[model samples]
Every structure is written in C-alpha cells, then in structure tokens.
Target chain A: MASAREMRLRIKSVKNISQVTRALETVSASKVRKAINAVTATRAYATKAWQVLRHVAEQPGRDSLHPLLAQRKSVNNTLVVVITGDRGLAGAYNSNVIRFVSQRFDSNAVPVKYIAVGRKGRDLMLRRGKKVIAEFSNLPAAPTFGDVSTIGRLAVDEFSKGAADEVYLVYTDFVNMGRQITTVKKLLPLELEGEGLVEDFGNKSTGPTAAYEYEPDMRVILDEIIPRFTALQVYQAILESQASEHAARMIAMRNATDNAKELVGALQLAYNKVRQQGITNDILDIVGGAEALSAK
Target chain B: MTIRCEIISQDRTVFTGDVDIVVLPGAAGEMGILPKHAPVLTTLKYGVVKIRKGGKEEIFAVAGGVAEVQPDIVTILADRGSENIQDIDLERAEAAKKRAEEYLAKSAPADTDHYLIMEAALRRANLRLDVVRRYRKSGMRIPPSDN
Candidate 1:
C-alpha cells in the first residue's frame, strides 16, 4: 500500500495525464470531422472516374490501348505503396498497416520494393531492410491532389519503364467513424473488370451502356485520362487513410482519458481509506490518553 | 432541351446542373455540345469552359482534363479548376506563374517529372489569369501587371 502522500501524488499525476489526453481527444475529434468530410466529399468523383475507366476497359482490344491497362506476362518485380500516419499514438493505425504489408510480402517468391508514403512506414521498411525505392513523408493533414500526384506518377513511370511489373497500394479504408479496414488494392495494370470492381463501384452497372464517340480518337483521350484517373485513385486512398488516422487517434485518446479517470477514481478511493485510517489512529491515541487521565 | 452538365475536379464536384449548351476546350479545338448530341469523349486543354443557360453564361477555367459528353449528360473532369470566375485569385495566379517560371528557368531538364509539373503549373496559372481578364464583368478593372 502506498503512503497517503504517495497516493496523493499519484492521483495528481493521473489527473494531469487525463487532462492532456482530454485535450488530445478534443483536437482529434475536430480533425476527424474535417478528415471524414474530405473523404466523403471526393467519393462521388471517385465513383464516376471508376465508372469511366470500366467503360473504357470494356471495349474490345482494350489491353493494347495503354501501358497502364496492359498486364505483364509474369510479375517479376512488385512495388508496394504503403500509406501510414506520420505520427504515432493513433492506436494501431500506423502499425496495423505496416504489419499487414509485412505479412503480405513476407514470402520471398517475388522481388519486392516499397514506396513509403508516411514516416512510420518508411522507418519500418528501412528497419526491416526492405528495398524502399522512394520515400515521401510529412504530407499535409488534408493533402491536396497535387500533393500526392507525384507518388502516382512515380508508380506509373516505374510500371511503364518495366522496372516494376505490378504495383499494389496498401491503405486503411475509412468505413465509418468506428470502423476502418486495411485494404490492399492493385494500383498498376488497372483492375478494370473483376470481383472487386463490382463491390467498389456498386450495382450501378445494371444501367444500359451508351455507345460513346471519342473526340481526337480513343488512344489520345486514354493517354490523358488513364494517368489522371490513376492519380485520383491514389489521392482518394490518401484521403481515406488520413480520415482513418484521425478517427483512430480520437478513439485512442478518448480511451486513454477514460482509463486515466478510472485510475484516478481507484487511487482516490485508496487515498481516502489511508487518510481515514490515519484520522482513526489519531483519535484512538487521543482517546487512550483521555482514558488514562480519567482513570488516574 | 437542356443538357445536364457536371464539372468535377479531383477534390469535389464544381458544378452540376442543366445547361442549354456547354463549350469545352477540346484538345483538338473548342467543341460545343447541345442536347441530344452524339456521345463524345475528348481530352481538355488549359482554357475556359463556357456554359450557357437561358440568357446568362457561366465560365470555368479548367486545367488539362477530360470531357465526356453523352446525349443528355456532359461530365467535365478537370485536373484543377474553379467553379466560378470569382474564385480565381489574380494575385495568387500571378505569383504561381512567376514561381513556376523562375523554377523552370533555373532548373535543368534532367528531372522530367518536376519539369512537367512546373510546366503544368504555369499553364494552369496562365489559364486562370487569362480567363479572369477576358470574362470578368466590364465594370471590374484589371490589375496592373508587375512585369
């Protein structure tokens, strides 16, 4: 049992910790709201872009249309772009993504490289002795499309140059405030039609397909749209990851604050018990002296 | 008949409404789409998108992007653009242009990505400034160029 003075000091320290966590919770709550808004706001555009890409890919002989759409015969080299939060204290927000990626590429079947988008991921990759071709860190909280386009371009260039056979993007998808799922998506060779496409684009494919005419021809339009669409996908993933990071941080801080409160409550109870015992002992001593004087 | 026009940037949808006609700065040239027009998919250039509805006209300065024109709907996906002319800040555009120009002038062409990015930045800035200067209300005075 800690002394009364030690218990008092412990309670004070717990209260101070709760204050810091409470402040952090408030800040993260506000940031999560903004980040979530950013995520939802661009969802419409992402759906539309995906639809267009699907439509274009559905056309015959689409495989030869663009290098992005063309799949390699065999994937010799693989690049993984892992997006994580710059700072920690977001529960398992950063570690979850890092672990998912490490587990995913644990097998040395194919030669793999990494493109780290955040500080945590970069550090983890370096510590693990992974081949990190490029590292981008310290991205703005609410990054703009321009801020992330460079990563997309690097991936695109790597794919086009035959340096990387396939590119995968690992990110935490923001489902709701309380739910975030780690998602692995194919970034290169553009998964136009497959199992995941329907899930992502929804049941909007039931509508009739329109016969589209391409101005300045399809090749030229695809040349411009493919790169932009790829960049948009990367941008959207970053937005989702940022939202998830904030939400995770908000929840973690709230839990910390609650735990601190619980600790303080338990310590306060013990401190009170010790204090009462001291008072009772003092009273006992005083009463013994009184009884001795009365008997004398 | 009016055509539904939606201009979407990477961040958000800028405009979505019915318009009489929409003119896009196509990669080939300027092309206008009316209601019940043939489906057309074209690459956009760094210029203004003119949307006419009734007697009023709304203009948007779009950087390079793509325009998809269906029979009833026309979707303009701009790389970067403003919904309204008033959103374009002249000083900011000028400053961006100056910065891009300075970087382009100083840096060597070894790095293709940076060079292309700066070039696009300059073009977008130029397009914004041009759109504001040309399409602004007659009463609004043009700011003097620092050059």
Candidate 2:
C-alpha cells in the first residue's frame, strides 16, 4: 500500500493527466468535425470523377488510350503511398496503417518503395529499413486539393517512367465517427474493376449509360481527365485518412481521460482510507495515554 | 424549360440551380448551351462560367476542370472555383500570381511538375483577377493597377 503522501501525489498526477487528455479530447473533437466535413464535402467530386473514369474505361480499345490505364506485363517494383498521422497518441491510428502495409507487403516478391505522407509513417519506414522515395509531412489541418496533388503527380510520373510498375495507396477509410478501416487501394493503372471502387457510391445500377458527344475528342479529354481523376483520388484518400486520424485521436483521448478519472477515484478512495486509519490510530493512542494518566 | 446546372469545386458545390443557359470556357473555345441541348462532355479552361436564369446572370471563375452537359442537367467540376465574385480577393490573386511568376522564372524547367503546377496557379490567379475586373458589380471597388 502506498503511503498517504505518495497516494496524494499519485492522485494529483492522475488529475493533471486527465486535464491534459480532456483538453486534447476537446481539440480533437473539433478537428474531427472539420475533417469529417471535408471528407463528406469532397465525396461528391470523388464519386463523380470515379463515375466518369468508369464510363471512359468502359469504352472499347481503352487500354491504349492512356499510360495510366495501361497495365504492365511484369511488375518489377511497387510504390506504396502510405498515409499516417504526423503525431502519435491516436491509439494505433498510425501503427495500424504501418503494420497493415508491412504485413501485406513484407513477403511481396517485387521490390516495394514508399512515399510516406506523414512523419510517423516516414520514421517507421526508415527505422525498418524500407526504401522511402519521398516523404511529405506536416500537411495543413484542412489540406486543399493543391496541397496533395503533388503526391499524385509523383505517383503518375513514377508509373509513366516505369520506375514503379504499380502504385498502391494505404490509408484509413473513415466509415463513420465510430468506425475506421485500414484500406489498401491500387492507385496506378487506374483499376476500374470491382474491387478498387469504393462501394459507398451506392446503387451502382443507375450508372450513366448515355452515349455522349466528346468535345475536342475522346482521346484529348481522356488525356486531361485521367490525370486529374488520379489526383482527385489521392486528395480524397488524404481527406479520409485525416478524418480517421482526428476521430481516432478524439476517441483515444476520451478513453484516456476516463481512465485517468477512474484512477483518480480509486486513488482518492485509498488515500481516504489511509488517512482515516491514521486518524483512528491517533485517537486510539490519545485515549490510551489519557486512560493511563487517569489510572496513575 | 430550364437546365439544372451544378458547379462543383474540390471543396464544395458552388452552384446548383435551374438556369436558362450556361456559357462555359471549353478547351476548344467558349460554348453556350441551352435547355434540351445534346449531351456534351468537354474539358474546361481558365475562364469565367456564365449562368443565366430569367433576367439575372451568375458568373463563376473556374480554374481548369471538366464540364459534363446533359439534356436536362449540366455538371461543371472545377479544379478550383468560386461562384461568388466577392470571394475573389484581388490582393491575394495578385500576390499569388507574382509569387508563381517569380518561382517560374527562377526554377529550372527540368522539374516539369513544379513548373506546370506554378503555371496553372498563375493562370488561375490571372483568371480570377480577370473575372473580378470584368464581371464584378460596379459598386465593388476596382483593383489597383500595377505601375
């Protein structure tokens, strides 16, 4: 049993920790709201872009339309754009993504390179001796499309130049406030098939089948739209990852605060017990002395 | 009959309403569409998008994007845009243009990505400034000339 003084110190420390975690929880709560709003706001654009890409991909002889849509015969190297939170304390938010990537790709036959989008992922990859081609950290809280298009461009360039045969994006998908699932998406070769498309774009049966006229021409429009579509995908992924990070942090801090409160409660009870025992012992000693004096 | 026009930027949907006609800066040139027109999908350029309903006209400055025109619905997906002309800060646009220009002048052209991005930024800034100068209400203050 800890002494009363030690218990007092422990309670104080626990109270202080709870205060810090409460503050953090409040901050992350506000941030998560904004991040989720950002995610939802851009969802319209992402879905539209995906729909257009699918329509264009459905056209015949589309494989030769653009390099982005062309699949390589033999994938010699892979580029994994791993997105994680810059700072930790998000309750496995960063570790979950990193671990998922490692577990999925450690035994991959082809060489895998990385383009780390956050400090936590970059550091972990470096520590693990992974080949990190590029690292972008400390993105703005509400990053604009321009802020993340560079990563998309790099992936595009790598794919076109034959540096990376395939590109994969690893991110946490913000399903809702309570749920975040780590998702691995194929970014390059623009997978228009069943698996890569996010199922959240509900009711796939209503896809536009109208044969529309292409201005300037289909080839030129495809050239321009495909690249922007790729960038939009990356931007959307980053938004999802950011929202997930904030939500995870908010929940994690809330739990920490609760745990600290419980610890303080338990410690206070023990401290009170010790103090009362001391008081009882003091009373007993005083009563004994008085009785002895009275007898003498 | 009116066409439903929706201009969506990266962040939000700028405009979604029924319009009599829409004039967009297509890759080839400026093209205007009326209600019940044939479906057309074209890439947009850096210019103003004009939407007219009844007697009033609403203008949007779009950077670069794609415009999908249907018989009843038209969707303009802008790379960056704002429907409200007042949102275009003249000083900010000018400053961004100057910065992009300076960077373009300094950096080697070998880095195509950065050069192209800056180039697009410069074009977008120029388009914003041009749109504000040309389409903004007369009651609004004018931008200062670069001496």
Predicted structure with the largest lDDT when compared to the true one: 2
The segments of candidate 2 whose C-alpha lies over 4 angstroms from its true place after superposition are A107-109, A126-129, A193-206, A210-213, A217-219, A293-296, B1-4, B17-23, B30-39, B46-61, B70-73, B84-147
- Tens-digit lDDT track for model 1 on A1-296? 88999998899999999999899999999999999888887876876776677666665666777778887889999988889989888999998998899888879579999999999889987998999999999999788777889998898899889999988888888988899988887877767555353324222532234667787887777887888787777888898999999999999999999999999998999999999999999999999999999999
- The weakest ten consecutive residues by lDDT in model 2 chain A span A198-207
Q: Write the per-residue lDDT of candidate 1 for residues B36-73, one digit (tens) a residue.
A: 88867788878888888776777888887888777888
RMSD of 1: 6.1
List the candidate 1 regions with Cα displacement exceeding 4 Å. Answer: A33-47, A102-111, A124-131, A197-212, A293-296, B1-3, B35-39, B52-58, B85-147
Please list all clashing residue pairs in model 1, or write none if there are none: none
Candidate whose DockQ is highest: 1
Residue-by-residue lDDT tens digits, candidate 2, A207-253: 44456678789778877888878877888889999999999999999
